[model samples]
Target: MSDFFNNKRVWITGASSGIGEALAHAFASQGAHLVLSARNEDALGKVAVKCKELGAGMVSVLRLDLSDHDSIPGIVRNMIASVGKVDILINNGGISQRSLALNTSLDVDKKLMEVNYFGTLAVTKAVLPGMITHQLGHIVTVTSLTGKFGTPYRSAYAASKHALHGFFDSLRAELGDTRIKITLVCPGFIRTNVSINALTGSGDKLGTMDEATDKGMSPERLAYKILAAIERGDEEVYIGGKEVLGVYLKRFFPGYFSRLIRKARVR
Candidate 1:
């Protein structure tokens, strides 16, 4: 339990399950005050209870649907009223995609962008004013390694994640002197239900976890590393096993990386 997170007010979206849920528990154990949000109120409540049991100073459950753009302002307001001021905003909410570029319809791509990119932006913007006023805050976004390298069957998902990198990189530069930090977490894979809930070309759920993800790093371990990165105020951190090697390959061996990605069983 680092003193850096003790009593810190942190808000995490997508806290119902997977990485978000893991993060909620990790931060709680570190003595952070948490505001957890997700579309599933029941699941959120379950997470909140666990947070409480983990010794979170305070835990509030806020039901949120990232796809519903119109509800963002109210959600932000409610969170602010309950938590006072958020010292850390973890934008962990978003959907994944499991469709080929040609098979993915415009509607499907739009939905992916709306949730993964725009939804993250919406929440960050809502919290920025307070952070600016205080002259301090940390924005940690949970992006995928696919953001850095495009994969065969996840074009739309990759695009949305790529947009996040662009947006946050620029934002970090813009806020350079404000003492605010933006950390982009590029996770290769974690054992989660992300694949199962990922949207297909026709808006259908994939409903099956990918094998790589099933054998990937544990979400709990990933959460710990993410918190360490936040504590260090790192610009970005990639968490995973051998999958993280792809980042290096893409940077130093573009041709080989490209061919490897093309043959990857991303689905």
Candidate 2:
């Protein structure tokens, strides 16, 4: 029950399941107006119903496919018209990778960048105008531990997440002292379908869950942490267990970090 989110219009992509779905419920409980989006319209509708049940101010289901860049602008326009305006945007829609770089096809790499990098960029640009017009907004991106440091099986996925960090960091510098805030959430393994949905070298789903991922933090717990960071206007926040230390380890002890990462069971 956060007063800050009361009646606030919050738009979340990939809201059909996993972390995105948890975020919707978390925001709803705080009385926020919810705009849920994903490729699966039926799934989004189901999430919308749950949001309404959770005491959301208002809930709207909007179909969104990140891969379809041309349709993003129109969807954003309609979302604003219907939900009034997006006060807070959760950039949570993204794909993951789980294949060695050498085995991975170039096409597979390109698709990873297309959805995770270009698709994210497209949505942010489309929403920026409205946030600017309102003179207030928050952009929360759900990057991963890979964004800070790379792993063996997630070459292109790491690249895409790394690209997000670069873009958002520059955007924050450009904004300077503005009411609009940006927060990059770099989470370690979370209990989600991300592993099963991860892309392989051939561009097919991994279709299996990693052991560490199975024992990782819950989405409900991470959602609350994200909400707290947004309220505080934090530029960046890392949420996870020991794996999060890799970000710092890479920075201060590159050689040691490299050896550890190589031996780590990323999959």
Candidate 3:
């Protein structure tokens, strides 16, 4: 473990499961003070116990609901008051979608944006002032491969992630030499319950796993990469398998990529 994270206070949203739970373990193993938040307080408790067992400096579990944007600031304020200033913030709480644009409802699209884009923005803003005051902070947002390029059945999900790119990119530029660093971590896919929890056209849970997600990289491996990226103070990093190629393919070969994407068997 790098000494860089030994005493750092890291706050992770969606820390109850999947990538979030994996990250909690990684940070704990590095001896960082952790604030883990998710809607599932029960699950968060389980993760907190394991983090403590892994030798976390201190572990605190707080329930968080991303879709409830109005409650974020107060929750963050309480967190800071209880745990001191946050040194690292991992914005990992988000839901995915698995319906085509035509089949997806407006409410579902709004909900995706509500949680993925707006909720994340709210949390970032809530922490921004504190980080600026301390003059020390690193924010790592875990977006998806779809954030860079669109794919079938993920129109809203892609849009929400794309919004993060736009907002954070501009913020990074606007920060202008501030110590506050923004690292956008784009992951192709990491094996998790994301697919099963994904929303369908009617806003109901898909409750089924995608074949690609079933065979994707492990969350532990991605957590390691994310840890390194944060330590290195990277502005942007992409982690995953060959699907990472889709970003460049779309960027440099729009026509060809469009044709290729049409044949993509994405659920």
Candidate 4:
């Protein structure tokens, strides 16, 4: 465990399960004060209990639905009041899409953007004021390899992740010399329930886990690496197996990368 996160006040969204839940446990082990959020209050409470058991200085659970923009302000206010000031904000909440572009409706795309892009932005903005006032903060976003390279049947989800890179990159530049750090984590795949919970074009759950994800990195290991990256103040990190090559290929050999990615079995 890195001493960089010791005693820091951290907030993690989507903490009910999967990567977010794993991260909550890992951070708590390092003695962080945690504010965990998710749509399921019961699950959040369970996570908080585990976090406390893992040695967190303090654990608070707040039920949050990121897609509901109207409720963000109050949630932010409550967090500020309870935590006093957040040292790190992990924008880990978002949904994935598993539908073909042709079959995807505009409404589906809108919903994806609302939760994955706008929702992340909303939460970051809500906490940024306090960070700026204190002159220090860290914003870590969990994007995907799909954000860097396009994949079949995930157009909307990919677009949302790509947008995160653009937004956070600009934000890092804008906050230069302000002690506010932004780290964009692009993970290829992680063994989690993301695929099962992913939304399809018709707004139904995909309900089946993808093979690649089932064999990918474990959330616990990924959480450890992410915390290490944050400690080193890295601007970006790509965590995955060979899938990370796609990023370099796309940059140096766009045509070759495109053809190869098209043939790859992302699902």
- What digit string (tens of lDDT, one per residue) describes model 2 on residues 1-267? 359999999999989999999999999999999999889988898999999999998898888889889999998988788777889999999999889999999999999998899999999999998888888899999999899988989999999999999999998888777788999999998999999999999988999998989999999999999999988889899999888899899999999999999898659
Candidate 4 residue pairs in clash (backbone atoms < 3 Å):
none
Give candidate 3 regions above 4 Å deviation.
Answer: none
Alpha carbon lDDT of each predicted model: 0.92, 0.92, 0.94, 0.92
Model 3 lDDT per residue over 1-267, tens place: 568899899999989999999999999999999999989999999999999999899899888899898999999999899888999999999999999899999999999999999999999999999999998899899998888999999999999999999999999998868999999999987899999999999999999999999999999999999999999989888899999988888889999999999999678
* Span of ten consecutive residues with least summed lDDT in model 1: 258-267
State which candidate has the highest lDDT: 3
Q: Give me the overall lDDT of model 4.
A: 0.92
The RMSD of every model to the true structure, in order and in angstroms, is: 0.9, 1.0, 0.8, 0.9
lDDT of 1 at 67: 80
Off by over 4 Å in 1: none
lDDT of 3 at 255: 98
